[model samples]
Target: MSDSGPTIVLLGAGHAHLGVIDDWLKHGSPPVRTILVEPRDAMQYSGMVPGWMAGEYRDEETRIALAPLVREARIDWRRCRAVGLDPVSREVLLETGERIAFDVCSIAIGGAGRAENLVGRDPRLIDIRPIDGFIERWSEAEDTAPPRRIAVIGGGAGGVELAFGARNSTSQPDVLLIAGEHGLIPGHPAAARRVVERELESQKITVLTGEAQLDDDGALTVGDKAIEPFDAILAAVGSGAPSWPRESGLPVDEDGFIRVGPTQQVEGLPHILAAGDVARRTDVRVRHSGVHAVYAGPVLATNLRRLIAGRSDLATYSPFGKDFYLFNTCRGTSILSYGAFGLKARWLRRLKDWLDRRWIARFSGR
Candidate 1:
């Protein structure tokens, strides 16, 4: 391979991988060329997405401008979607027929909502997964006229936050959360779930729990109980990566998650690396949350550079064994929890907002 060849090809703009790109620019470029293959011009912060939906944060406030970052990094920004990979050739093929060559490649494309599998999969139903699609769909929902009965599927953090945000965003519309499991915030503590449930109830947003399914006509039902019809449906359900990885012959888990070693390198292929939601760290069976993506960035950057320099790989990635939660409450109250521990107050919300804003500012070169 020539020195001018692509140094590392980053496949996704997920949390940690973007940080790696930032760090690479801060220090210096590696010997090889760097290329970022993503479909969007900006990456949204998943942490502040709830705030954006809630009318507390603006769209621009939550995004990192990819154009500026690409210019500053002096890396090739292929504004295209990565369809699949040839791990043997170290080539990434885009949906647009563009092929990028790389000495090292990383996959961070993340996942999408299982929209098609849901019943009543109407064109009006919105899956708030990838940030780009969410913004566009939410804009449409806002434009839709009065008496908007919106349904949010899934009971996880994203679902509850989105439910709160949607309810807070409108006055005339009815916001409903359809939790597939027993309660809102399934894995969260009892107190946290109660708080969210109480808030949704106080705001007049209906909360339903059961095996809810949507039909093709946008109707939602929970266990033979025909729920109120929804003008807009937002599915915040869990996601898996694009099927391209599994088809590409790369090793993936049963859930379609890419398996990687601790160094963020794809297992069985040293030349390939992965981070963010797509990469499943073998040692730690952590949930596919954005927190892992945040920590994987530096390690990936360092190890990628070291691999280029022929240096040894560093330690593996590990998650803190505590359950951490911070509620970006729509009521201007941020509730924070550490494992079984919990804290709630107005000042906490302000502090959390300040921190989120500061992080966004950094990405914009502030």
Candidate 2:
């Protein structure tokens, strides 16, 4: 509402947006009125969440205090959810029925787990994303005496990490990982998969590689075989875009993620941009990982400022050739994978812990 400058609206407090805020704080504020709309004042750094679950970190260690950061950056922080977007009118509709106009808008709202198809829909089922809720539930489960059998759906990093965390956190070691044919991080190399499999075996965690379905009796069935009954089910499957992007008339990918160019601009909409898990860049082969989101932050920030200033010179985001993905096994060890090679060792775990701590420290001003 400032007459002196155009308004820049940032949606979601994702990792990429954290970098944007850091950049704004490091340098001076841009010549634009900035507003950050997020559902929570604190964001859990996803990278440290697995460690937190594994009892290696406290809740405060994994949390990023966005309130002080926003205050320091002199940005208006709205603690609300963005239900819809109006590209034509250049406005964002909040859940409270308020529309905030922006000259430029950036979205970094991360993805959510695809859990609609699961049967039962019981209270015991949970998703790994929207991590705060999952942590709360997990804490409650821990306090009420750990479940006898815990089942984690999906084989990706989230699932594997969650499985390991659950195994380490609970007294009961009966953890089942249902990968559904992908067989634990299919995107990684064969060696990485083997390492994970070996670690799972060493941890005494049961893994079902085939397709799994929840039966009417609350039993998990894998290829016509009814495995042990699971007291708690956690879904860490593929990420799905929230319905708001498509419902708001923005161009999106087949998976419903907002489509963006190399500069992270929303397709066909120059005034709007998107990054992190909610965005799919058309110009590059970028995976929906926290690494890519962190890398894209500065680029997104620069491009947004350029667009706001009516400058044609904008930055482009190029993903790294080999992204280093480290998985903490919760046994004082970690597996580091890049492309087709992986290394599993205790030193890697220490390195990962150090890197994660450093990243969090940057945002926490510690």
Candidate 3:
């Protein structure tokens, strides 16, 4: 953290950036000045969120305060959002109009959900992106108008987990999952789909297959059909990249996420790198997930350190095995899936809890 050497700006206190900081804590930070800029004071680990929603864990059990971690790590933490960027000049524009320059940078801000038309339709409408807000809004909703019939949008892992969590609520509300155009899990095998379908039937969660949209009156509109109304809506559909990356002229995929190489380096910009939901690996088609980000953290950290130390050799992030994929059912059981294989088990619930807690423990003293 020298004031005179090169500067590396680690934007967004995402899972991967936290990994970089932990590396500094263990092996000592690089001599280069390190700056960590993120607006949020705490990050609610997405892995444990479903469990918390199901009343299986407390609020504190799932979140880590960023202030302490940044303070202990001695990082130059900025409590402001980044509104813009200029990769050509190596500068990050802050929401406060302050521009930060860096010799190297890594962008790990989480994805941005499509929330244009759906938000203001109703007070009960909730989109699950920008997770911190979701937690806060959920708290308000819980204390006020706790929903009796909950509709979970999206068929991905997040939506599926939300459906189960809602079902396990204290009130035991009716849960309906609108899986969008792709029914249930699209990439999973037919056998895995059957396993999930069986669970949904056993749990009494109704499943709808079609793309869902918000109508003028905040109703769930699917093409020409108006779906049955629910007391609350939770949109867990996947998110695309935020606007700043593309506005800053950085190379992005069709979805607007930065494209990185095998070594986690930004596609054309070697001095800059990205990981987690904000980046897509160019060499391999890796689905964005917290599991991948947590595993790739070490590789991202190593590369950032190497560049500062004048080392030519950098580490590559290899995707781990499918055994790590665990989806909570909130039925005292969880589903494990990788490639074409999927299964649900009660012990898998304990395994999911252990894995989630272990990851959070590494970054917690608070």
Candidate 4:
């Protein structure tokens, strides 16, 4: 790094930003100094996370140590949550009472779960949202009896994966997937949905679709009738950007996600860029899949370099026209979806396990 005074402050270690950090280190860093400000020392790879829940892998297997990467890149690691930003002053104020000055900045603080929105919730009720927090909850729950009645409130891949993982790992918690929508994985191919539906049925996991709500008694209600009582509720629904971005005065979309150009730079703020789940592209609403985040890394890195070199920051980020989605459903069988195509087999599961191990290995330095 040059002895230049300018600095680039990255707010969170989101998936794409981690790849960007790796690329910038593997190649060469810009003259501007780099600093990563995240609340956690390790970043959990969301892809292998389901395996951890299934008891097939440990928590350590899902996380990558960010300290080494930050050191190798000669970047400072600020352990704190960003509360707000002063664009005119070009400084970020953290919740820990420290202010970081930067010539350029990027935000990737990630999404949050609104468990507080639930009515009459137990303070200890597990909300499997953040990796670190969820790991702790899972550990504690493991020591106790397996949850007698568990409701996973979402129909997305995450919810499905978690439901199967719980069933595989525990004494069958009377698992039920409550999807408010018409079906699980609404926009996914019908073939893929059918496969998942069949798997859920085979596992004896209940599927509640159309209309459902989690009442105070931990009961999932469907159209004025209480279906069942749950010992715990794990929500994978209503995921959105952290409240900080909108509160920080950045230009965010109606859903509170930051809007970015193809170059990954914030729409109005040239010096501030965003990627990962928090970023939304106006032209193409890419499925917030890890693949897109992985693919956006190089582009974000190149544009960051260009911005530092007094050149135009222009890099194209194209969404995958045909996303190849691979997920393991706890019974050691894998599901694959590419565009409208679908496939499932034990061999596919092994392949997915290998792929996840390799991907995590890159970051974990195993």
Candidate 5:
């Protein structure tokens, strides 16, 4: 290492970067001068966000204090969004027009919820990926009179969870879930899907399966049929890659997600690395979930440290074939799924709560 160590910049305070901060706290900081760039001082743990929405936990329970972690790790914290990156000059341009250079950079900004295309320019659309904003809107909605009907777009786990959360949080009994043609959680086993479908029925939520779009007046149109006007629209659809990566001239997938090899290093750009939803592994098809991001964190940290210290022996990320997923129904029960098998019970809900709390405790320094 040189007299002044390499400047390592962490682009986002997502799950993977949280793991990096945890590692640094435990093993002592790396030799390099580390910097963390994120607009928010705290990051909400997505796993417990449904619980918060369902009134099972307080709002503060879902947040992890990022400022404390950055302070403890001796990292320079920038409370701003990165608007652009100049790879040729190795500088990250901030929204405030400040250019910060880095010898090595890791992008973990997560994915962007493309609400514009789904809602057709609707003015009253709320997306769930950026949990902070969603939580704020949810609070405002809760404070006001409950809507007669609310529509949740997307059939994946996020959509299902949000539908249940909204049901638990509101006095309105009419919650509708609109999914794609494959139905709820199409990638999961049939049994798992059945559990969610049955719960939706039991909760009195209507399920609409097909492509859907919002009309100019904010009405949901599903395959030539226009449904009743929804008072509120919650979008839990899967996220798309942010624009910065593609505009940065980095190698990215069709969706604009940065492409990485097995080592989590951006293809054709060894100095730049990425993980979490913002990154796609070229070797294998990985789902964009918190599970994959949290698991990839340690490997990312190790590889970055090695590269900084002039070590050729770097670690590679091997994605899991089958991972355990817990879905909180927000109705006093939860569902656990692994491969083709699934289980739903109150005990599983307790387990999910414990696991989520423990994970958050790590970063919260509790």
Candidate 6:
């Protein structure tokens, strides 16, 4: 075996990359030169964000710093963002006007919050993706007089948690949830939806069932009705990919997310891989969440190592059979959902808090 293999670029400090680093830390040093490209030294764990919004967690608790992991694994840390990818040349272009060539690459840059109609029309609206940005904006917003009328768009898990968490906060701004055409928690099981629906009613938050569109004046219309003006608006409609990857000529699904197979390899580019929200599985339908991302991490690490070693055999990513979830609620309670099974209780909130802290602590090295 060669003492050193090819250079592998680890793009974005997302969950999957953490697994790769953790694997290297415990098992062995990186088999090849590794460089991590990210704009921030640390990233917020999406799971605990709802709790943070509800005043259950401090700012520091939600962050997982990259320094300790990188130092332990001996991976080069690039404190900048990747602006472009040239797969044809196997190089990543950084925002700092530098281009680094790589023999293999893995992207975990995460996805942008889908705010196509809501946030684009209203610049003041906050988006839930790029988690750190949302946290910063919301924290600043909370410092001033709380917005009396608040509107949260979307009905997915993130949207539901944000709506309920906002209502639970000390400010307790009146929250209006635009559940969209499919209604509350559309893809979740019947029982889970019912539990969340009951929680919303108990919180006294307004629910609008229909598609949310913006008029010319930045006003919102739900189906056929006009809603009251909101001093604060948040969009958690779901995630969308950045335009650069597609522009770079990488294969992507209709939504612009990089198309990756079971091995986390970009279609037609086996040497380049992607995972997490920024990547969409083409072989199977998989739900996008922090849970799935974490599950795919070890697979990503294994496959990346194989590619770097010039080996054809690689590992594949498979989703867990039953992934459980918890949603933050009022009065230090939470909604626990696992397929058809679901519950709402104060003790469940403690469990969710412990799980979030545990996940963060796993990599925090603090």
Q: lDDT values of the candidates?
A: 0.77, 0.86, 0.83, 0.78, 0.85, 0.85
- Which portions of model 2 show Cα errors greater than 4 Å? 1-4, 118-120
Tens digits of lDDT, candidate 6, 1-366: 112447889999898888888888878865578989988988888888887888878889899888888887899888998999999888899999999888889999999867864435675588888799899889888887677778999898989999977887768889999998889887677888888988898889888888887777777778667785888888898888888999999999999999999899999998899999999999988878888888888998888778777789999887757367888884688888887777999999899888888888788753
Task: Work out how many backbone clashes candidate 4 has.
Answer: 0
**Regions of candidate 3 where Cα sits further than 4 Å from its true position:** 1-3, 117-122, 320-323
**Candidate 2 residue lDDT tens string, 1-366:** 324469999999998999899899899779789999998968888887777877889999999888889989999988999999999888899999998998999999898766645434667788877778788888898889688789888888888998998888747558999998868897788899899999999999988888767777866778788886678888887678899999999999898999999889999998899998899989877888899999889998898889888998899888867377999999899998888897799999999999999888888862
- The alpha-carbon deviation from the true structure for residue 251 of candidate 2, after best TM-score superposition, in angstroms, is 0.5
Listed per candidate, the RMSD to the true structure in angstroms reads 2.1, 1.6, 2.0, 2.3, 1.7, 2.1
Where does model 1 exceed 4 Å of error?
216-218, 321-323
Worst 10 residues of 3 by lDDT: 114-123
Candidate 1 C-alpha lDDT tens digits along 140-163: 667666336788887888887788
Of 1 and 5, the candidate ahead on TM-score is: 5
Give the lDDT of residue 270 in candidate 2.
89
How does model 2 fare in lDDT?
0.86
Query: What value does the lDDT take at residue 29 in candidate 4?
Result: 78
Q: Work out candidate 3's RMSD over C-alphas.
A: 2.0
lDDT of 6 at 262: 88
lDDT tens digits, residue span 227-331, model 3: 767888888878768988888888998878999998888888988899989899888887788877877788888998898787879998887463256788887
For model 5, what is the C-alpha lDDT against the true structure?
0.85
